[model samples]
Target: MVIVDDHALLAESLELALNFEGYDARRVELPEEPPSETKLVSLITRSQPRIVLLDLDLGQHGSGVRLIAPLARAGVDVVVVTSSTDEPDWGHALHAGARTVLSKTMPLGEILGTVRRLNHGLSVLDVEDRERLIRAWMGQEQRIIEIRRRLDQLSPRESQVLEHLMGGLTVGEIAKLRVVSEATVRTQVKSVLAKLGVSSQIAAVSIAHQADWRAA
Candidate 1:
């Protein structure tokens, strides 16, 4: 396993703990200006670890969040261990392919137990985090369903774009899926965000979890 965090002390401490658990761990202290995303992509392709313990806030890079989707796309499992409690981050991390989000403020034992469970193919999520995510998911679902119910308010193309958006596809990906230009998808995304009163994609997704909008 590998740990990516700007904090040296936290990295070292986690390394010690993992070593005690019979796991090999390494730390990568990314520089102020990280190498290209390509280089980080190369590292993951080369290392191919079992799991990545990622910190959401890594100074300016925030490579941790950026890498989640790519790593997951490459079949790598990620478990986020970060201080961010932003509802959108929770949904974004999961949408980006994280298996779980373990808060840093939790007890070390709980953290260790989560890691162990994740390693063993069993999920590790505290009840509170679990419930919170459930709510976020429900909220997102509700927003999507309501929007769809009022599809007449949207142009056919906008409705199509929104379908892809709700499926967690990035704007670029949605453009390709719809065989449209990137700019069009961006426009649709902006419109969707505005119509839903969401400032970001994360909030849009968090609104998807509402039971009223859970594909009923």
Candidate 2:
């Protein structure tokens, strides 16, 4: 088994535990600067381990989900062990061809049992559960696309005003910054809310954030 996680301590602990449990587990420490997908795949291929434990969040790479497909092609089976609470990430990992995603909070015994089951040609998750998570990921992706479409409806000025709102600025502050009247800023804010199909500034800001909206 190969463990690919950023945290040194956690990796060490898991290495010790798995080794003690009679599985040859080693940590694949990534470089300080994130490597290219090709380089990453090369390192794992060196060991050619049957199973690789992957973490979804790898610093600069945003998420390690992209690694799953190439690794699978290399004949490595990945079992995601993540501490992230993002349901979308969990679902995304499964979609990228992970064996199963296990929470860090799950009991150690249960995790070991999962590995043991895999060794014996058994699955940890049912087909229904995998389908459910994949469906959830697809739904979240659709929501992001829709929200971004709404953001696209904003005029350039309205987009700037929305940015100010997200930055915690008051209408008067935005007006002064833009060299415009408070009334003008308020009107833009209203237009922003309307175009976003939201009722308030907070809702508009939340939608912008959820969609990761930003000017090119």
Candidate 3:
């Protein structure tokens, strides 16, 4: 097993406990000042641990949720051991392939027991936590459906304009890309904003992000 967390003291303690329990657990070291996602992923790949105990907030290194899917695909079961109380964080971690989400506040004995069970091919999640995750997923699904409906209301030209807007392009830049007059691009932008029920280009981009939408 491998532990990936920015809190050095907590990680070391967890490693010691795991080892005492007869598990071969180790902590990942980031020699670089601020670790990159690529470097962290490579370290896990080389270690090839059966289970990865991950923390979502890696200080300056950003969220560890990004690593969950890739680690799972690489045959490593990810157990998110995070202090984050945010529902979105929990939802994202589980959606990205984490087998279990354990709060850092959980008793050490319980944490170790959960890990042992996971290593033995058993999984566990509390009933309340499971319900929260289901609710979050349902809410996300509804948001996606609404965004798709709004997108479908757009005309072909309006859709093209919205895509460029979401790409961070200026009106002038979009006009240049499409070889259209700036006035024409502005007109299309207005139509897109109206159909999407947004007031500005930024709002349209926000909608795209919220729905995780990209141009088809």
Q: Per model, how many backbone clashes are there?
A: 15, 0, 0
The positional error of residue 207 in candidate 1, measured at the CA in angstroms, is 18
| Candidates, ranked, TM-score | 2, 3, 1
Q: Ten-residue segment with the worst summed lDDT in candidate 1?
A: 207-216
Candidate 3 vs. true structure, TM-score: 0.63
Better of 1 and 3 by lDDT: 3
For model 3 the local lDDT of residue 144 reads 79
Task: Give one digit per residue, the lDDT tens place, for model 2 in 1-216.
Answer: 899888777778888888999998999978778788999878866877999888887776557798999988888888999998777778899999999999888887787888888878898889998998898899999999999988988899999999999999999999999999999999999999888898999999998999888855
Residue pairs clashing in model 2 are none
Worst 10 residues of 3 by lDDT: 30-39
Winning model by lDDT: 2
Tens digit per residue, CA lDDT, model 1, 115-193 = 8888888856666776677578667656666765544455667666666666778888988887889998888778867
lDDT of each: 0.73, 0.87, 0.86
Worst 10 residues of 2 by lDDT: 55-64
The residue-by-residue lDDT of candidate 3 on 1-216, one tens digit each, is 999998998899899999999999999985657657677798877867999999999877778988998899998989999998877678778878888888899888988999989878875776677668857966877887898899888887887788888878999999999999999999988888888888988999898778777666
lDDT of 1 at 113: 86
Over 4 Å off, model 1: 125-216
